[model samples]
Target: MLINDLIILQRGADLTKIAEFKLNSFNSFFINFIALLIFSLGFALILSITGIEPWLAYIETTIYNGQILGLFATLLGVVILHELLHGLAYIIFGAKLKFGIKYLNIYTMDISGTFYTTFEMVVILLFPIFVLTGLLLISGILFPGLIYWMIIAILYNISGSFGDIFMLIIILFMGKNCKIKDEEYGFSIYT
Candidate 1:
């Protein structure tokens, strides 16, 4: 879906595109790989700090007896929930919400004309990472059997959020009070 479609759906203030960073297949892959690497390293550091043998848990693989299908279903549900959390954050910050899928990837946008503070936008972008990781970590601690799935979910969600993290880094350097319009592949920030 185009931004115009979102404008029509929201029927709210007009947003002018100030800057856009488009992500093609190669760039997206590279960014996601970097994100995965960083997140994994950070997680390993945390484990080490807590006196856990990171290498042992990291290398151990669990065999799925008859739960392969269930695992995939749960993964799909988690992916959808991740996008919904993005939309929820946008809504919480008083922005109109629109969701769409492009090239089999799902995305949510805040299309309102409200110019958000740098702190607000950063919180919106990082909200899913915080919420999802927190839940998965808690689940892993409470249910030993679900530890494998929890780790996978946390890693997948963090890696998938590469684009948001990239955008946040860019927005951090921009002036305060910049209006942001989220698109499927990227976002525009106007001063």
Candidate 2:
């Protein structure tokens, strides 16, 4: 099948394969979760100990009573925009989107079964970094009270984007042989 016609086998067509896929993905998700948690907590602690509050944090806690709500809203907006960029980029580059595949054990998920080019994935991966930065800048100026939440949201995006960046690095290193594996034995084979 062409990359454009790809589909993720949610159940893997058999119990053994299904169990294997789940186990592999579960392990990956667990490691990612722990890494993200530790990194984020450590970074936040450093900020606290150094008395280096981001400008947004000061404004958020000081002025508005609804600051918490604003932060939550901004965070939700950031995540939605990030995923949308990926899906849209896939579509624009001639790929179709299957259901998003969230690893039940992790805070992140895959945009499952997307039919896009390597170049398409790269662009999609970078899109949110730029887009989110622009949004943060504009929102910071327009709504200072949401700054703390915005910082958290940006950090979250960057942490997740780390893997995408690494994926791109491997693709570049491996040349055209780069493909996201769906399984060890039954990957969505790419040419």
User: What C-alpha lDDT do the candidate models reach, one value each?
Assistant: 0.72, 0.54
Q: Give the TM-scores of the predictions, in the order they appear.
A: 0.71, 0.60
Which candidate number maximizes lDDT? 1
Which regions of candidate 1 fall more than 4 Å away from where they truly are?
1-18, 35-64
lDDT by residue for model 2 over 66-157, one digit each (tens)? 55666567657766777776666656655544434344322222434433345665786687777776777777678886555556676766
Model 1 scores a TM of 0.71
Clashes of each: 0, 0
> Candidate 1 overall Cα lDDT vs. reference?
0.72
Regions more than 4 Å wrong, model 2: 1-24, 34-42, 45-70, 105-116, 176-189
lDDT of 1 by residue, 88-183 (tens): 888888778877766555778765545566778888989998998898899889998778677767777777777778878787666566666565
